[model samples]
Target: MKRILLINPWIEDVSAYDYWLKPLGLLYISSALKTLGVEPVLVDCLDRYDSDLLSYSSGSGEKYFGTGKFVETVVPKPDCIASIPRRFKRFGFPEEVFRSKLQQLDHVDGVFVTSMMTYWHYGVSDTIRVVRQELPSIPIVLGGVYATLLPEHAKRNAGADLVCPGTGMKPIEKALLFLGINKSVQPDWFDELSPDYSAYESPHYAVVITSLGCPFRCVYCASSYLWRHFLRRDPTKTAEHIEYLVKSSNLSDIVFFDDAILVGGGFKTLMKEIEHRSIRTRFHLPNGVHARFVDRETADLMYANNFKTIKIGLETSDRALQTSTGGKVFLNDIYRAVDNLSKAGFTYKEISAYIMLNLPGQSEEDVLDSLRICEELGLSPTLNEFTPIPGTLQWKELIERGSFAEDIDPLLLDNSIIPHWWKQGFSLDTVQRLKEAAWSLRRKLSGE
Candidate 1:
């Protein structure tokens, strides 16, 4: 059988955490490759449960709910951000471990690398560079959010023989064709294929998306740009996949990675299916759900289904800011949603509110007011620093407004680093203060 080696590259950033992060797209591609009769081998650098990695880290244990820090090694900051004072680090398995894994593989047909944030392209390029050194003759393909968002940049810098942009099986098919394999994937692959979690030896958590894309066009979000239309899987099929994961793997957590999981009421149906199947597992919704859709029934369903972590997208409590940013939610929506969740037996610890900071034209008071509202509603506050995505409406608007040059380095767009460079928004000290405020509020809510 023809073999393709799949790699999830290291994350070179100031900081990163494995908040139930999984290469779901790559796993799906692995399944697709299998269906096409191609053998797919995986080398996931971020797999915290990787036995080799565990041994390398001296058997460090994971934190609560299988979410914990990646093994980090401090690295020099890129020249563009050298002025920034924070220490830049590569967060994942050591380079030696990755190289050792590559050396063990025998005669792979090609290599496929997946990327995450657009700013993390440095990691992608470095990963491909190493792959080239190891297997000089083998072709390498790059695909994922970074490549899709900035294809030309990836082609120029990522060092891949072929860069497949966009989503779904089409990108995987493109990669296969580049390898001279002419095979078409099934049309219903989205629903038919499950992420090949068998790639991991023993994952603590498995992330599953019941839907693709978002229905709302939030200014700062790229979900609408990434996927033009919204689509959902059969809830029964989704439940079946969950049951399979529970039965086949030693998984303690199931995370939903959908951008808008609660839009069409399919989540409720899926909850009922899980209940019907009697599959007991700790579920989490780290992705911010639309508060407008969080009715009493939905809250009850989430509670009955044992959702351990629920995050509601309450971007800002300011009325104008709420309407300007796609109007997907409002202050009243947040109020009602919290009430429903609290009535459904979810306490402040189980529920959290996503309060965005550093939004264009937003004031410090706006963020403080949002935090105050979270406190009043008895919900933990999570401060999400706003990073203007490349193709989103917000990015374009900022460029047009002359916030920064159109061709600014994507790495400077990192939220932690943006405050240092993006002068139109918050200063580095102000951002620090805002983070401290959020932390204080969280402590207060937790009764610390």
Candidate 2:
């Protein structure tokens, strides 16, 4: 039997929070391997419920829905931006604990690591360093958003024996072939694989993905770059996965991480099946779904079926910014859509409007007006800081701007600090005030 060590690496940044994030990509690979009959062991660095971490922190020791702060430690800067005035941290288990955990794994033939935000390659690099030091010669494969975005840079810096940009199921399959293990059947994208997450202590959330990729090629987003094509599953099959998780795993809250859930350019039959028969499940879309996809009929279908958390990307009120951010939707479209959702019988509090901020040359006033629009539309405004992704259009603009060097340490692109917050007169205080007000209003609307 092949023993594989799957890792969700530590996050290195200024500030890190648990916003219902899990390594769905890594878990998919883990589950896929298990279904293929490999012995997969997980060593998630960001396990908030790790016995070593829980032994130290206060507050009930742990929380549910994979929502809680990670045990973090201050670390030195990467010397490129040592002048940046903020404490950098490694958000996860301590190194000693990590090493001890790795040792406990005994013997593993191979390692699979997952990466998130491209700039967090520092975290990816550090994680690779530890893995290489411990195992020395286990063929390690790196794949995920970071690996996908910066393939060449990661190929050199990540020090992995093999690097998988985007989906590397083929590469993984090839490696397994070399090792004399063969799959009787090929791995299909939509075929549901049973994931056993019992290895991690108190793993609570079940990630239920109904589809893959997005149709909209938003210039700022990497969804297109990652998958390049959109695909959906048989709704009956999707419901079956959700049913199994809820019934067997006891995870009621299942987050759907699809780029667009209901755009059903295909699989309309599957969607109708889900609309009719998906059993009790609390759905979440922390990644935010496209509002344009949700019509009165579809919204009603979602609400009636299984969706609990409804979030949509309204980007901003400024029409120019809307076009600038890829012209995904117009202001009036959101207002009418919000009306339809309420008419379909969902409360205003259940609706969330994602207001994006910190674009190149965007004013604070622009961000504020977007927030005002959300407030007026009776939607909760969730402010997300913009980070310049490497291959996106914004990356070229940042390169044209001052002092941004090529391959200059990925840590500068952390969204929390806002690398290029240089729009004339915008103060951090003003940004903070806008965010605080947005949160307060959202809470009031939520009545929570």
Candidate 3:
């Protein structure tokens, strides 16, 4: 059997943290590789559960908070990202530990890497650099959101031997086939297997996905970038995975990375099944939940199922921004949804509404107004700046009107580090003042 290694790289960013955040793409790919009869070893650079972190991650050792803090080292910020105020970190284990871990694996055929948030491509590059230094000839293939969105850049600059864009099902099979590994058998699509989290060399949280893809094309989002369509397993399958974690692993909190979990999709039928069966599990949807689908009954179902924290995408309170950006939700929808969640027995502070700011033509007044509106609805406001995703409808306009390079580096795709600061009718100071005003209102609204 040919040995294959899958690596989930670290994060290079200003003020990074983890919240049940697992690389679902990597886990799914790893599971698929095993199904193909490829003996795979999964290496995670962002190991909060590193055994060496006896004092930090655990005492004599266990990971903290289900998914705990990363072992990060403050590094020099890249030239492209230096303008940002905060010190950035390379979030993961020490380089020596990574190297030592790699050396232990014998006769690895090829290595596969996964990436997320386009801005974090540097972490991917850094991981590749380490891997190449240790094992010169092993082919390093990169895939996931960033690779899918900017394949050319990933191939050219990110140092991957080949980039697998979009879904890795066909590409991974093709990758294995090229190496002369053929499997005449197929495994169950719902691989209820607990990801070989044991490969981490430390006790830590696991990454699992209940479904795939989001149904809507929110102009600024890349949910549709990786997967062109949406699909979900029978809730029974997902529930089984949850049960496995709770019963076997003794995990209490798991995060759902689904973009639109219950968005009028077949999720209702399946979610209902899990609830009716009264599965004793507590789940978290740390990825922003879709507000438009939150009818009173759905809210009640989610609440009864022990979903503790819920975040909604109320990108802007302005009807125009809501309709124009995603056509996914609007003002009346926010009002009704908030009412539903509130009636379903959630305190205002228990919920968060993600507010989108800094879109190319978005107004500062609109940004603050959106925050104010969230306060009125009695939900905490979380501001998420708009970063233009390539291949989306807005990508065309950013090139036409903004300061973005026609050849902007893919690393500039990080949202926390603003890439495209827009001018409201050519007012340069508008960006600064708008951000300040939004922050002020947030403080006042939350009574901080």
Highest TM-score model number? 1
Model 2 lDDT tens row, 1-448:
8888889999988878766667877776677777788988888888776777667655322454456677788988878668888888998888998898887777898888889987788888899999999898788888888887888999998888878776636656754565466763255745655345657556566766777787887777877777767877766777766666676667657777777876764334544665566566666777777666667877676677656677888877788878877888887778777877888887765788887777655677777887777777778888877767778776776777753776766776675755444444247777678778888888777787
Candidate 3's residue-wise lDDT over 1-448, tens digit each? 8788888898888757766666676777676777667788888776665565444443322243475566678888889867878787888766777888888779899998888877787888999999998899898888777888788878887898878886737767666665666553243454344344545553334555666778898787777866776766666777666666666666666667777887646556656876776666666666777777888888888788877668887787677777788788787878888899889898655677887767756777787787778768877777776777777778777778765776787556565565355444324455566667656655665678
TM-score per model over all chains? 0.98, 0.89, 0.88
**Model 3: residue 305 alpha-carbon error in angstroms:** 1.5
Per-residue CA lDDT of candidate 1, range 1-110, in tens? 99999999999989888888899999999999899899999999899889888888865457889998899889888999898789999888888988888888989999
Q: lDDT rank, highest first? A: 1, 2, 3
Question: Which of the numbered candidates is closest to the native, going by highest lDDT?
Answer: 1
Give the local distance difference test score of model 1.
0.90
Give the clashing pairs for model 1. none
RMSD, each candidate, Å?
1.1, 3.0, 3.3
Q: After superposition, how far is residue 401 of candidate 2 from its true place, in Å?
A: 4.9
The superposed Cα distance between candidate 1 and the true structure at residue 201, in angstroms, equals 0.4
TM-score ranking, high to low: 1, 2, 3
User: lDDT of all the models against the reference?
Assistant: 0.90, 0.74, 0.72
